[model samples]
Target: MGELVERVDERDRVLGVVDRAEAERRRWMHRIATTICRDPIGRILVLRRAEQHARFPGHYDVMVGGAVNVGESYEDAAARELAEELGADVPVRFMFKFLCLDGVGPVWFGVHEAVISQPLVPDASEIAWNAWLTELELREVVDRWPFVPGGREALRRYLVSGNEPARPRSAERSPRPAAMPPG
Candidate 1:
């Protein structure tokens, strides 16, 4: 059986549940939880997706997270994804949530962060490798390396808002620089 996920609307209200494939095919909004694993000194963990993965194969991803499963809360999914992708179970603090629109579709992403000093065991099937990069180092590669669009968006949002929620605000936001090409 295919994985089941909740279909949601722009406001994050669940419209219904459907197979993951179907949800993707129809371009429905869905829930996703992404986590930023930070080191004690403040560098963020990044993962490279396996080369054979269906989406964003071989691209660098800022967070270790995935679709929120049926009946699962975003926090639970974030923790589950952290363990499944990197074999770490450190406590995560909720940062903020945002709606992302990329080539694939729309997905609401919950951003969380955790500080860990433990070694990570990457799941070979899900992540090819992992590294901890400082914000400056990440910026150097942001445009040079191929990253999951949603991941880039989330990262940009996080950076712009200074770790706060990136929701639209009455205050005008400064225009952002163009992103590096997707490798």
Candidate 2:
């Protein structure tokens, strides 16, 4: 038996719990909670997936995340994934979610962002290598790198929105964009 994940519908309503493998095999919609981390100077943290990873092995990814466990809120899953993968216990702000049409199957991708102030201890099972790249550097290499397909789509949507995570005590409040309509 593998990890249990919530099977979701097109509107992201939970249908039932299913094994992660079963969900993938059936092409069932599910939820993935992802976080984009940035340094204080605004460089995005990017990492290469470990070669042993089951999905997109050795590919670069700007988003750090995984499947949302059954009954977990997107926010909680985002924070949990950040701590597990990067060892950063930071607060993450929910940005937006979209139905990712690309990749192995459709999933409601909950996107979040965090500014990491603590040192990172990358998990060997998940990250092979990591680096902080300026937005310009990331944009330049995004096309050339063998990036994960779903992550690439997330990044595209994020960049287009031009919204940054709110810093503590910042008065600026960006309006949340409506969820992307299912294609």
List candidate 2 stretches off by more than 4 Å: 164-183
- Which regions of candidate 1 deviate over 4 angstroms? 164-183
Q: lDDT for each of the candidates?
A: 0.80, 0.84
| Clash-forming residue pairs, model 2 | none
131-181, model 2: which lDDT tens digit per residue?
A: 876666677778778899888888888878886433323232123211211
- Expressed as tens digits, the lDDT of each residue in 62-121 for candidate 1 is 888989998898899999998888889888887889988894678899998877788898
- Least accurate 10 contiguous residues by lDDT in model 2: 173-182
Candidate 1 yields a Cα-based lDDT of 0.80
User: Best-fitting candidate, measured by lDDT?
Assistant: 2
